[model samples]
Target chain A: MVRLITHNLLACHAKGCTQNNFPLQFKDVSIELKEQEVNSEFVKNFLPRLEWKALVNTARQLGDTSLPEELPDMVDDDFLKALHHVLFEIHVEEGAMVCPNCGHSYPISNGIPNMLLSEHEIG
Target chain B: MFETPLTNIDYDKVYEPAEDSFLLLDCFEQEYQSIQQRFTGRVPVVTEIGTGSGIVTCFIKQNILPHSIFFATDINPTSCSTAAETIKLNDTHETHPFTFTAMQMNLTSAVRSNKIDLLVFNPPYVPAENVPEIPKDLDDSSWLDLALLGGQDGMMTTWEVLNNLENILTPEIGIAYILFCARNKPDQVAETMKARGWKVDVVIHRKAGWEVLSILLFQK
Candidate 1:
């Protein structure tokens, strides 16, 4: 159940892999889409906190071709729908999120990710 | 001396006012799902101490529907009233049956003897140099004394909440999720929760700028 925003901050917490450890790549993924009522005002307000490029790229990887190549000047209904889908609708049910830098894998089982690292992985 | 009108100071403007916190509201979904997975279909009555804007409450109403009764409280009467109004406005056209009670109560005075199903709180856990002055109406009441500030170390309110848990919480209840700012003494909070005979787990953690936020789920 890693939200894109949560996924954004998650990097390989493995020792000494701090540099370039972000934008973790998702693998063997399963997602569930639950359509929540579109709240455009909320989407408009959330734009500032999002990693736009990362979100666009990740949504592409997940086969969601809803967002535009660049964030639009105005948040129209189309844009808000896309933003809502990418942010709230899609859920990572099961997958292994691997850190690009440290190559550490956090496994997701039954929609929950096991983020605990072994003794050696803990700094 | 000139007095400032409370309405002139926009409460919503004080917050970052972005829906990102609403997106971060999704973090509660993960927490909710995890609880459901662990508990398996038993939904408890939930009470959120500081139900800021009702974002998380709305999430609960939408995602974990049918099993939970939600009661949200805040020190700020305006915030509580606004949250209640928002919930009412959103649920008007929908068929989602939810009982949301919004009350203006301070955390310390808010706790009751009844055992709650789930206790959720996002307290003022930020460490600040000076505690912000309370408004004229809330001057005598410590409830609105900066809902985000936890004293010099940012754990004063948290400690107070924990101390009062014995009176408010019951052993029959399964879980309580307390989201605290990472910059504060989280370990101390964890240690305190542990000392109180509850199993503490760090379910979700996010870092925003210099401050980090963690969702800690405490189970009896």
Candidate 2:
């Protein structure tokens, strides 16, 4: 499935398409939200390792403008809650993650993204 | 003992948890204290490659590491969907324990480098004449062959996962548990991993019918 948490870790691995392949752009996504208690400690620990710009842009693409373009000097509970929602709650039920460099489209059907490359695309 | 999560899994299409899978779970149980100690403070990114029934991933999440995010990948779309169901069934407690995501992809190819803290793989370790072709279509059931057949002493696919470990695992907190059978040569595999400068051990082993199954633990 396409969650920002998982999406953050995925890069285009099709053949030799290497440069600027990260943060696969979301296109035609069906978003689903589930309510869960925000764990501040987890969110805080994970925030430092996240790609801030990619996450913000992806959330915005999913019609969620809760995150800021830049992380604040001191992230408060509101920021942590927003990060938790963006990372854990929102799920892309149906869509395609297109590689920015390679132009390969990984289709998401039934909430699972098919990252299998074609025969010619396998390196 | 953690209950095996195999609810709603069509065993004919997806892999059914067997002795190899149980041996992996046993090792986790045996090393549960150490595992908990290793990841006590942080929210580790735990991933399982080739999640057949998603039983091992579900077990680790529900029982061993409740405070982690999990990513599971399977070449077989059926296994991916089946694993998602297994994860959902185990994560239904009101607390909403862990965030899990499944992808249909090759082993560890879709995951980012140095992001996974704990990795688990139960690769296809049965010696076979040929490594089966990976199914491409969404509804293709031929992937069940890829779930079990391992060419050249069942090491074809296993080697791919092992070689990619250095890139997939977080250097500080990475620990991988991989299953190997006697025919696949467990001792030699451990030696190879040790040669790669990893701290390796046969964490658990059991004689299951004709096959001798062992779970090889690796740390970077």
Q: Judging by lDDT against the true structure, name the best candidate.
A: 2
Across all candidates, the chain A TM-score values are 0.90, 0.95
Report the lDDT tens digits of candidate 1 across residue range B96-178: 22345554445524223444556777777778775564454532444444666767777776767677676565565546777
Q: Give the CAPRI rating of model 2.
A: medium
In terms of DockQ, which candidate is strongest?
2
**Residue range B44-140, candidate 2, lDDT tens digits:** 9999999988888888987898888888899888889989998877666747436788888888887878899999999899899889987666557
CA lDDT, every prediction?
0.62, 0.86
A120 in model 2: Cα distance from truth in Å?
Answer: 1.0
Q: Candidate 2: which pairs clash?
A: none
Please tell me how candidate 1 rates in CAPRI terms.
incorrect
Q: Which pairs clash (backbone N, Cα, C closer than 3 Å) in model 1?
A: B124-B148, B182-B212
lDDT by residue for model 1 (A58-97), tens: 8888898888888888777887877877876787868887
Model 1 DockQ, alpha carbons vs. true complex: 0.01
Residue range with the least summed lDDT across 10 consecutive positions in model 2 chain B = B90-99
